[model samples]
Target: MDLQLPRGMRDFPPEEKILRDEVIAILKNLFELYGFSPLETPVVERWEALSAKYSGGEEILKETFKLTDQGGRQLGLRYDLTVPLARFVGMNPTIKRPFKRYQIGTVYRDGPIKKGRTREFYQCDADIVGSSSPLADAECVQLALDVFERFKIDVVVKINNRKVLYELVRAAQIPEKFTEAAILSLDKLDKIGPDEVIREMVERGIERTSAERFLSGAQDPQAFKNSEGYRELEPVLSALRDSRVVWTPSLARGLSYYTGTIYEVYAKDSSVTGSLAAGGRYDNMIGQFLGGTEKIPAVGISFGLEPILEVLKEQRRDLPLRKTVTQVYVIPFKTLVAEGRAVCQRLRRAGIKTDIDFSAKGISDGLKYANAYAIPFVVIVGPDEVAQGKVKLRDMRSGEEQLLTVEEVARQVAQRLS
Candidate 1:
């Protein structure tokens, strides 16, 4: 009998691991620079904690990998970091208010294996909790731009207000009872056409006149210029304008926790509906688990690592390839094993990423492996050179060789690599 891994999952090979680590380092550096400290939550949580917190779509409910733990407690793998963050905040209210945190980890779902969508993958998230002001929303938007900028992906940040959508429903005179369904339909405006939205609204019991009013009026900025949502969010737009950031109003992220500002990032040239990154204001999310007593306003953004990688695969010229960190590999001839270890130590002590070919592969094969791994330089030690307190250094890229003492070799390699 043979055991095999399930579908919609994969094991990352060395090259992929290198690339993924590069991405993680880039985001981690930026997250720290932006004042977000790191926080990690459990990969599995009580099912009730996740499912009960948000009234998300049927897909999330059904796709979650649920099972019974040893204690007979129902548990599920986290579908996303946001919900887990909310649970963390709820469980630890004594932590400082307006907490800023960043999390990077794997999440699981049961979606079909496709290019951007995956069953199990990683997500990079940064969130600011305990603030409802659109300034929080603006900061989230800025964070998204910063992450993309570090990755060298040019993107347009799209912004919208759920409050504005609700106000539109009220303005259209849609029945109060049918607001939820109307909002869902409005969320799909970019997916389906305006006509299909009109049809959904009708099917959802929205009046014909109200449906027409929503389709026509919701698209006009002036129509919302004097509305409540616009009034609350205009200052945020003004702030973004002062900083010369382009902000659009077409983003309606399809999630229930988002009560106010919603946003997404997209490539400037692509028409793909899937967002590279997205999040929104969920002021009442923590309160959901905390008995709705304390009002903790919050907003956040998450980058879809897999989708961003896919975009890079398409835009190779614009993407920077991950470079190996090991700067030098010390290779010793058959008789100079001790000198080889000494050379590796000297280079490493000097703050250069150095390693020894302990496998005792011959010099030719060792050099070939270094070339294959893209190691920039090689230090070759042999009996004669070791006796003279010198080692041979070869430039992997140019195939140029020179003999220098160990100390001098380190200095020479540093200059060459630099």
Candidate 2:
């Protein structure tokens, strides 16, 4: 029998794995710089713990993988990081208040298979908890911008408020109960047209009159900009007056947890493809887990690593390349291998990435090996050099050779490499 990974799953080859690792490392560095610590939660949790929260009235429950453990306990792999984060905060109340954290790990969902949408994937997330202020929203936006800047990708961030969405739905005379469905339909606006949105809304049990009004009103920017959604943003807009940002009324995210300012980052040209990253303000998600006893206001964003990777791949752009920092490759005769190893160790202790050829190859072969590895400098040691307390340094790139003492060689290589 031929064994293979399940459909919608992938095994990253070395190059892809290295690229992902590099992206994760860059994210970690920037996240730490922004004062957000890290947190991790279990991949599998009780179905109740995970599902009840997303009752934001989406189809997430149907898309989750439900199963029973050996103990007959109901469990499911988490569909997203945010729900598990709320659970973590609820369980660990002793954690510092206004906790700031970032989580990067894999999440599973039994959703449909599509380009850039998989059954299992990694989400790079950072969130600020216990703060309801728009400043929290602003910082999240700024950090997201920083991520894109670090990646050297030009992007445009679209921001909207769920409250604005609710107000728009109310203005359309849609019942509050049908607001979730309306928002879900609105989320598909980019995929489907206005007519289809109206059809979906009506099919989702919204009255035809209300659905048509909602679609028609939202179609015109002036109408939307003049509605209650616009009125509610007076304070947020005033506060952001000093900070220049593009405002868009069409940024409603599809998640069930977002209670306020939701956002999505797109490539500069919409024709470029999938949303590179997205997230939103989900203030009430913790209430589902902790019963509103704890004061935990939260907002966050996640980098769609795979989608962004695909975008970069299609653009033929390289992520920031990491160079191997080895400054010296030492090759010494078999009899003097210990001396060469000692010298390599000393150079490493002096804060250089240095290695010694252990294959006991000739100096010519060792130089060739260094060139093959793209190592710039090669240190050659033989009986004469060992006796003379000196080593021959050859520049692999320039093919220049020189004789220097161990200390001089170390300093020269350090200077050149640094």
Candidate 3:
């Protein structure tokens, strides 16, 4: 039998899964606090919807895990949450306008398997649909900023409007047919440098001078003052009060759906090379799902949970080392297992994560078990202590034991853990 996981697959044991779950908890809490409602969608979609409406571009479609069901229906695992959101909105015509939702789920991509990326990973997304106002874009940026800040990861955000780049592409004499390819080539500027970007543009049939003009125009967003992209972007920049944000005219979000404001988040003073989160204004995707040119303005941010997990692991300061969620472990004298069980019930009812040893083991073995899992506290209930309605609470880390009433133990453990 094969014991090894497939390529780009991993098993997060208790120690790792605990940390990942904690991060998810914090994210879900923050998402709600920011006024976004939770949503869920199917992981598999019809190949037609997945391939057509989600046309994030050729590069993305190339990574899709396509399959055909036994019923002869073509299907594919969703590659991103945004596309699912668009499909959901388009299918439900009676849904409320300006729908705001957040979803965290697994997405599959058969692309490059790097440290921060994988074939299967979780995507945490918050999106606002049916709203075209630039404020929607700004709000998405703010959410991304707040998410990283809360995670103690310092970051800088590069904001750009696709319209801004479109005008510049036109200014460079790039024909409409070559606009998307030209933008995609320029998206590689930071990675491949100007010579390569120009080379790529030339390869895409753009004139050498026109490619150079496109690169030069990226440095100046004000050059297209009268363009609609500039007019729409001014308010987004103004509304973004965070000092971490900056307007980059050349920031093509590397996605075909982004038709307006786009942003990418990068960690500061960190070794991670990928953006922690990214999203943009995709006004035409939903309209495509609805089979029309009528734009349903949508903007969103996706927290690359795997990358965020990598960042958290790299820092190590915030990730707890505990292999178990048990905050307190209970051990009772062989004759008093019932009493110990009662105490554990009380602790759990009080909303504390508690575990008890049902084997009625010796105190030494009990304490050793707790220590192995890094359980912070141990409650020893012997006959004498049980008689007085008190127990011996031992601090595993400090090796200090205190004789206290059950109430005192509960109160102290709750306070310390809280």
For each candidate in the order shown, give its overall lDDT on alpha carbons. 0.80, 0.79, 0.87
Clashes of each: 1, 0, 0
Estimate the lDDT of model 2.
Answer: 0.79
lDDT string, candidate 3, 266-291, tens digits: 88887787888999989889989988
Residue-wise lDDT of candidate 1 within 270-384, one digit each (tens)?
5344779888888888888787888888889998888887776677756545456678888998767787888888888887889888877799889988988888888888887
Q: Model 1, residue 123: what's the lDDT?
A: 94
Query: What TM-score would you give candidate 3 relative to the actual structure?
Result: 0.95
Error of 1 at 73 (Å): 1.4
Give candidate 1's error at residue 168 in angstroms.
2.0
Give the per-residue lDDT digits (tens) of candidate 2, residues 1-418.
Answer: 9999998899986557767888899999999999999888899988887777543345777788889999999998888888889888877777776788999999887878767778899999999988888788878878878888887778877777777677678878999889888988988888887789889999999999999887766665566666555654555556555333456665668778888777788776434466777887787777657777755678898888877777666565444332444568999998999999988887788777898899887887888777766788998888989888899998887989999988888888888877
Residue runs of model 2 more than 4 Å from their true location after superposition = 1-3, 54-57, 113-117, 207-209, 226-234, 238-244, 269-272, 311-329, 361-377, 392-418
lDDT of 2 at 58: 52
- Predicted structure 1, TM vs. truth: 0.89
lDDT for model 1 comes to 0.80
What is the Å distance of residue 223 in model 3 from its true position? 3.7
Q: Residue 384 lDDT in model 2?
A: 89
